[model samples]
Target: GESVGLHLPTLSVQEGDNSIINCAYSNSASDYFIWYKQESGKGPQFIIDIRSNMDKRQGQRVTVLLNKTVKHLSLQIAATQPGDSAVYFCAEITSNTGKLIFGQGTTLQVKP
Candidate 1:
């Protein structure tokens, strides 16, 4: 599947501001979730991940949160910069299938 959908949600932020990206997953059985950042014409890069057993996890400058009740996930980026501008995606991997199903991406546009 294409990483970026035809109509992606856009998130605009200022430099040095915190950015929060949200996603809604479909499968309740998915046990693992990963966040990816894709720059223009570049492949997706691993950002952070969270497992079903955990509700929240933090990375170098990012945080991932999972809510099973609503099948919701969110990524928080601290002190967003122009370099952080890109399309962000959330993927879910079910233990049984071992397949990564990518959700719709959100384009992050950063202002200087």
Candidate 2:
């Protein structure tokens, strides 16, 4: 089964810092991965993505690293700011349907 439970509603951080958020999935057969950021009341925005065959991928200020050996995934934000405060989600694309299975998410708070 997938992770189904409550999580910390938010996280607070000072401006101009680094942030790291984490998530785990249940299916080992998942083939694609994506990271998204959702602001206060808006829908999710695509940040970065990594394929199952890749180990790491990078973008402007974000980086997504996947370790299939342990089925672990991580996102690193180079510099966190108030503008960066939002709920971050990691999703794995399942085979067959190709639907994205989203993680619980981590809310990052950037205090200015």
Candidate with top TM-score is 1
| Residue-level lDDT tens digits of model 1 in 36-65 | 999999999999999999999999999998
Model 2 pairs whose backbones collide? none
Q: Which TM-score value belongs to model 2?
A: 0.88
* lDDT score at residue 74, model 2, on the 0-100 scale: 82
What does the lDDT read for residue 63 in candidate 1?
94
Cα error of candidate 2 at position 7, Å: 8.0
Would you give me the overall lDDT of model 2? 0.80
User: In order, what lDDT does every prediction score?
Assistant: 0.87, 0.80
Residue-level lDDT of model 2, residues 1-112, one tens digit each, is 6441113446677788877776666678877888899998999999999998898999998999887877788888987878898898888887765787887788898888
Looking at model 1, residue 75 earns an lDDT score of 92
Rate residue 70 of model 1 by lDDT.
83
Global CA lDDT computed for model 1: 0.87
